[model samples]
Target: MASRRIDVRAVSKDPTGQVLRALYAYASPDAGAPCTIEHDGRSIAAREGEPIALSLLGAGVDTLSRSVKFHRPRGPMCLRGNCEGCLVRVDGEPNRMACAAPARDGREVRSQNSFPSAQLDVLRVTDWFFPKQFDHHHLMVRYGTTINEVMQSFARKMAGLGTLPERPAEAPLPEEIDCDALVVGLGPVGLSVALALAGEGLSVCAVEEEPFAGGLVRDSLQWHSRDGERLCGAEASDRDLAKLRAAGVSVRLSASACATFDDGTIVIQSDRALWVRAKARVFTNGCHESVGAFGDNDLPGVYTARAAARALRYGVRVGESVLVCGDEDPALDALSDALSAVGAKVHRLTEGERLLEATGSSSVSGALVGRDERSAHKIKCDAIVASTSRTPAFELAGQAGVEAAQDLDRQCFASWADELGRTQRSDVFVAGSVAHGGRSPVRESAVARSVRDYVTKGRVR
Candidate 1:
């Protein structure tokens, strides 16, 4: 039977989509020799020398395993290899992250603590039987004599969670890099800053936390040039991506902005920790989307506009119907565009009341959005996409004492900035949405250039 071709354009705005497409192309046996490792009863079609899970997700398998206690379905959450939400058993190993796990093609992936496949897991029966009882495993106490025996006799005992296989340990190594300017974030603004710096022949480094560059651009169809030209459609964006890479700027993909310091030092972690000493730094870290503060808002199928954009760009169709509501323009506009691009029937409310309730018990069936008075209406959808504006990724900036306030207009926290985009800290410069200077191609370039000139000329003195 012919396999269904998921719309790859859905996730085209996300940089990860490119990595996923590259991985799939490299790993498919039909294309060439599989690029993965093969072992006893375990084989992963490896590409890019990483685990199979990232590729699988890029190929559209977000729900790797179900929750242990509630038996609710779960997928990749913290892609940082930290959150155990995506845990699945590979070969003889138990409870490993699919995002961090490499796909070896022939490798056997099994559901832990559940019968049959992770998708159709029978252990979900526990949710029906023990409804409110959130117990995945029980606790236990060892037997003893005398006073210990007396306590043991009175107290009941249970066992803890099962163990995982031992892994080989090794000492870590240190690495370093030096650049004239380091732009953290590979979004449109980040790439723009890097390109601008490279145009001036400055040694610049652009770092993106995701496995691929381009940041959110891969999922978005709208691309703007400095002259205010709307570069929509997938092909133009891909061409732009190639141009960014062709520039002399060093693009660090799959790297994170781990931390920042007072002396213009930046720490990024990928396979290992990299200490970067740059003459100056620009943070285009962007904003966070808001989730509805209602019952079961964190359930599967519930996602932010950015996440929806990712899902579509990466061939991960949310569902047949989509519900989109938000406070701002870009997010709502983006979500609407992505959903329409992927053939999803969309019902949108730009500035409606708050989300009252998410209808379905499992997997979404519908949602309730308060209208006015008793006229609250129900928006039926398989997926809910929302944006409550965005907050500056200010953890690092907050450490530098960049002042922030709740903006009455956007109804979100924004940073206080001067005319030249320099923060209160004389050494630090802020750019992109991180500075809350409003989002636009022109504004971003102006802010980035101000900082670039400040760094290149030392004019702040």
Candidate 2:
């Protein structure tokens, strides 16, 4: 796994070239400011706003952390912060989400839950000892009550998080503010809701975890319209964001909504603490890309479709040869094309073909695909982009009293919402994949009408 940065000039003439250029413009030589971060005692160049996970991966340093019990290697599964696979210690802080944190010059980053190093953990013997399952209760029973104390002490030493800081860091004071409506996500649906509400003379506050506001729009190569016009996803998102700002919608980037209360209080965390009190809350947090359950799926070079797109957009070299396999969808097709445009040899598995396992040691070297349970073949490649259907991001909605049930047909959890995006709670609503469990036509007018009625009428229908 040698460190390598993809050459941006190779894809300069491609359609998605503008996206890669815009994403990595800050890291360019002409771009001012030297941003270099130290990881595992090695200095790596980084962009001002680029995620630390991408920077580390670009430097050929995968295996951000090790599994707690078996010490198995883990890398970034979802470029978004939904998955804990990319947890790392940053600047003496343990268990920090690398994918969510921006790389800062002079910052020290290290992997957690591994002795020696994440790539070569000595505690990996635990995997061999407990090959099938890891139940401490069962282990204790087998050893007898006499060894209880010894077992407890050994378990505490073996299975634990990173070491605590010698001195406690100062916590920032909380800032409180009030608004007419609070939008929890800044995706297309969330942006639309904010714009529509703000246009109606209501004060709005929208929060997004990502540094940018477009959500998936920023990752797509080109969006085709019914009128036969090809538009870049990032450009469209920027246009919409501008409209929201013009309408007086307060936007918070690189901020996460930590929690929501029944009393209409929303807690957000970024550089500081922000407590927002709003009359109505709208959740358009979208969905998380689902990873398939296969052997070595957590390998360093195995990426989800969303993660692969993010890596390419950031001009990170995922691999020279890649295997794209997932549920049959246009998004998968677009990602394959995008990877090929970026000079990577792209190979796609047939629809309905199941990925049995990712074959690799330190990094993915190939993928095993099969049409049936017994028949399978190996495809040689340096990387594997694997994904299944997306699961609705229902955590915020669930906190606000929305109900979610498993949708067996879709193979994901689906939230219950009316056509107008209204949930069980009168003050709460949902939109986009968070409401539908999958991609659907954006019901802009319907969501807008519902929000207006809720704000004006102040009652749940």
Candidate 3:
């Protein structure tokens, strides 16, 4: 199937009813090679390098997975792996993340935690039967001992991600590496820090959880980076990623740094464990996007604003009629306009307006929104894009002995940092969104310089 073309520079203000929930050719996206994959015994064709979620959704498979307990419908809420909505079994591997895993020819994708099929899961009756909550422990005890045991057994079988892998896989021995500075993310800020440290002749090793190095900045669609890069969206990330490689900075992709020790050792996990001991550690890890409580909040069509926008690069229209809500993120404006460009009616709830409830059975069909209790009204929409305060990813740094406190004004957990990104821990520093300034060029650059200076003064030891 062919796709409709939408350009960021020349987007139309008028909504056109031309999109058909199929692939769209976003302006000059250097698309990957076409490949085929098997989904639940059916064949699907999509770009080779695109994520499994995009490939499956483009093939008209909407219900990706069923909720564990209630069996409510679920789909890709976050194109990134932060949300657990897109979990699926792949090639006999249980609980593989569809949004993070890339598509390959002959790869088998199947929905898990559903009986027979995700589309027609009879298990969803549990949602209706127990409108409040299902107390499995005391559910059948009133009947008898035998009946209670049986109910417990059924509940046990119904829970969990999926069965074990096809076979037990062998574990590899951990690998160890040494570097002058360890940068934990590869977003525009992370890349800038890595490049700056490398320029000072320090050995830098940057680790990114995404399969590719560039971060969500590229996914902003229309918003540009204010990090003094003067580049917008994909251009900023593309150039910085190239620079990181040319400068000989070792970058490990699709890996996460799991732990940090007092002795300056960090453990990273991927296919294999990596023990990295660096003189200084800089965390540029970004924040997490979230949504608020509402009716059928976990429905298949509810997506974080940035998450839905990220899929557009690969031509995945989240929904034809989308209700943009919650935080006023800069990216939401671009998302609203981009959706408008491709035949979607974008309804953005302004200040004082809020989403009261999301309506739909399997996926969102409309939303109830209002500025006050008496002002509520329903807007017909197929998708609901929601966002809240961004919580800085600080668990890894906190494990390294840094402190974090929740910001009431911003409603996020922010790390305490001095002028040079110094945390409570002397050897560990933080930058990027993890720090206070929120993705500022000055913040990232100053922290990188501090790391360079510490190493230059032989303070690393």
Best-fitting candidate, scored by TM-score: 2
Candidate 2 per-residue lDDT over residues 217-330, each given as its tens digit: 776655624236455666667777888898888888887888889766545567687889888888888887767788878787888887887787677757779998877767
Instruction: Estimate the TM-score of every prediction.
Output: 0.69, 0.91, 0.89
Candidate 2: residue 313 Cα off by (Å): 1.2
Ranking by lDDT: 2, 3, 1
List the candidate 1 regions with Cα displacement exceeding 4 Å.
1-73, 76-104, 107-165, 169-172, 223-246, 263-269, 328-343, 349-354, 372-380, 439-461
Q: Give candidate 1's root-mean-square deviation (CA, Å).
A: 7.0
Against the true structure, whose lDDT is highest?
Answer: 2
Candidate 1: tens digits of C-alpha lDDT, residues 1-461: 11112444343544424323432332332332345443222343444434545444444344566765556666554343434556776665766666556556456665554445555667677678876664332322233346555544533221222245455434367467888778887776777777776776668777877665554565454543433654433444455556777887777776777777755454545447677888777776666545646766655556666555554443444566778776655746756755665467888764557777667754567988786538678888877776665667766666667778565555666665655567776556666777755453235555556666767787554
Give the alpha-carbon lDDT of every model: 0.59, 0.78, 0.77
Writing each residue's lDDT as its tens digit, candidate 3 over 343-425 gives: 67789886788899889888888999998669999999888999877788888888888889665556677676777888787
Give the Cα error of residue 439 in candidate 2, in Å: 4.7
The residue pairs found clashing in candidate 2 are none
453 in model 3: Cα distance from truth in Å? 3.9
- Evaluate residue 134 in candidate 1 and report its C-alpha lDDT on the 0 to 100 scale: 44
The model with the greater lDDT, 2 or 3, is: 2
Please report, as a residue range, the 10-residue window in candidate 2 with the lowest summed lDDT: 23-32
Cα RMSD to the true fold for all candidates:
7.0, 2.7, 4.0
Alpha carbon lDDT at 93, candidate 2: 88
